[model samples]
Target: MLRTTIMGLCLAAALASPAAAHFQELLPSADVLPEGGTVDLDLVFTHPMDRGPHMQMEKPLRFGMLREGQTTDLLPKLVETVNGGKTAWRTSIDLKEPGTAIFFVEPKPYWEPAEGKYIIHYTKVVVDSFSTGEGWDEMVGLPVEIRPLTRPSGLWTGNLFTGVVTKGGQPVPYAEVEIEFVNDGSVTAPNDAFITQVLKADANGTFSYAMPRAGWWGFAALTEAETTMKSPEGKDVPVEAGALIWVKATDMGKAP
Candidate 1:
């Protein structure tokens, strides 16, 4: 009876633990390009805080870049690759003019058996070339997106990042937002709570977070889609549509 009681207690504790948050990463080689050059992008789906056990990412439904109020198709440029022993993608873009390149991806709906739902995260990142910083606030017309109230680029550590959670060009009031920093094997979390920071948007659909470390930070505003999708087992399930935006923070130090 004691053994069974101990086993039951362990099971209960495990069920109450928080799971690591999943983030779709759209990272660029450089957030700011002083001189025009090619910028390489890494597309991966994984838990940024844990930094391992990457989930396989299939070919995205759409991949494009928005600059100067124009969208350019980049799906054909994606090259399949492996990251963390899982399927991922890589692509590069050449920028010669002064503009803000907003790269975005609409990944195919991923089925999460553990969550019993389909996950689709519309991920994007801003890369400024020649430091023009123009059109940094332009929207890419994603199904779900985070409209940045604060400048997404040219940010220093400890800067407060603010954005509005929008779905179909409208604000989503009191949405839930998850924040995670891309762990570079430097800092360790004390416990599961430190793995992913969670917060709710205000009534205006706006949320903010101050980045403390110097690295890539991803903000994911999650919500349920109005439509449901058929699971692999022929059962309809809810969809977890996420609007994710990535920003880079640099330390205040002299340039080499």
Candidate 2:
């Protein structure tokens, strides 16, 4: 009887533990469009480090692009798609001029039963068209955002990406930031702890991480919202607001 009781306690403990981190991915087909053309983007919410167990993302609250100080609504162009057997979104935009295009999405609040909270991630990605090299650091004016200090596009492997965490245009001191790489089944983690890399921003709300691999990396600055949301059970739960940015790193190699 004692052994069975102990087994029950262990199972409860495991269920109570925190689940893997969920990252909202806004991945573009190419970070740099040498010649102006249409670039496709994939919007998926999942544990990018594990590359599975995707969460269904409802239609976003807002989706748009910023180019040359003008914001264009792209929500009408979003097409429903499936990823990892879950609902996702996809859209494409044509760059007609040489400049930087910042695509951003504000997803609907997702209710997590385990955590007992609603999650809303404001995610964005930068695509440089014709290498304009300007407007890479522009802000999308999200409630919580990461203003990139380093150029967001055309990065080489091992480049240190830096950004400042902000809420309502003001810096968030010592914010918690989570980093994860988009796994393509080429690398494996030794343990669960190695799956998600975490760090804290300094007093100025600035943090940096060097990309170790040549692939897409996502940085999420997580914080609580000022208000709560009603969960499906009709209970008011806290809101977890995440400001995420995706960047691509390329390895130095000769072109074929």
Give the distance in Å from residue 116's predicted Cα in candidate 1 to where it truly belongs.
Answer: 0.2
lDDT of 1 by residue, 1-256 (tens): 9999999999898878876688999999989998878999999999998997799999999999999988999999999999999999999899989899999999999999878999999999999999887898999999899999998988999999999999999999999999999999998999888999999999989999999999999999999999999999999999999999999999889330
> How many residue pairs clash in each candidate at the backbone level?
0, 0
Candidate 1 — what's its lDDT? 0.94
Candidate 2 structure quality by residue, lDDT tens digits, 1-256:
9999999999899897768999999999999998879999999999998998999999999999998889999999999999999999998899979999999999999999988999999999999999889999999999999999999898999999999999999999999999999999998999888899999999999999999999999999999999998888899999999999999999989220
Report per-prediction Cα RMSD to one decimal.
2.0, 2.0
Q: Over 4 Å off in model 2, which ranges? A: 1-10, 16-18, 254-256
Look at candidate 1 and give me any clashing residue pairs: none
Candidate 1, residue 42: the lDDT equals 96
Clashes of 2: 0
**C-alpha TM-score for every candidate:** 0.95, 0.95
